[model samples]
Target: MIRLGYPVVGVADLTVAAAFWTAALDLAESPEWARDSWRTLVRQTDGERVLGLMLSDSAPEQYPRIHLDLLVDTTAEQETEVERLIGLGAQRVDWDSYPPDPDFVVLADPDGNVFCVVDLSRAPSGS
Candidate 1:
């Protein structure tokens, strides 16, 4: 049976991207699969969920249709994590698509790849 693998992100510089993402996601580089142009980040507890960073010269998408959404338990946690990510080279995007009140905050990585930090506690039960 075919199963889903890790999500691969395009980056202009593997080292820089890997560094930022690994720290932001609290992941570690899998040395066994390490390469100059590619790197895999895995969670320490169980390496089931992984993120792959591949070197690319193309520019990042300003408005990517597909992006990662990081979930935090509480609004306070979400705010703290967003600030921490910014310190690690993430930029807060002045998103124009948000509703009057949004449960998620959009941020762009060092390479300008967009992602969101979400607080599900504030969302409706079925959302």
Candidate 2:
């Protein structure tokens, strides 16, 4: 049997990405897993590894095929989290593909990696 590990994001600058992600998600840098070109971020509450960052020279995709979706219970919480993430250096994406009434907001990290903040309460009727 196999188990999935944490998501690994490619970033242009390891230091900057590490700082933003750790603060934005309330994670802490895992010093034991630190490397010259890699960072491991773990949950502060339980020390469970959640995300990894890898130094890469390639640019982020404008429309990434795979992306993270941060969840919130309510639309109000989603709105607040979006603002908070922007305050932490995330930029709102001018996504042209949004539905007429989208339950998710698109954003890009400092490194331009795209992700979504989804409101569970506003999810599609069947979803």
Best by TM-score: 2
List candidate 2 segments past 4 Å from native: none
lDDT of each: 0.90, 0.94
Q: Write the per-residue lDDT of candidate 2 for residues 9-76, one digit (tens) a residue.
A: 99999998998999889999998679999999999999999999999999999999999999999998
Q: What is the Cα-based lDDT of residue 1 in candidate 2? A: 94
lDDT of 1 by residue, 29-105 (tens): 88867888888899977975589998888998888988999999999999999999999999999899998788999
Model 1 residue runs over 4 Å out of place are none
TM-score of 2: 0.95
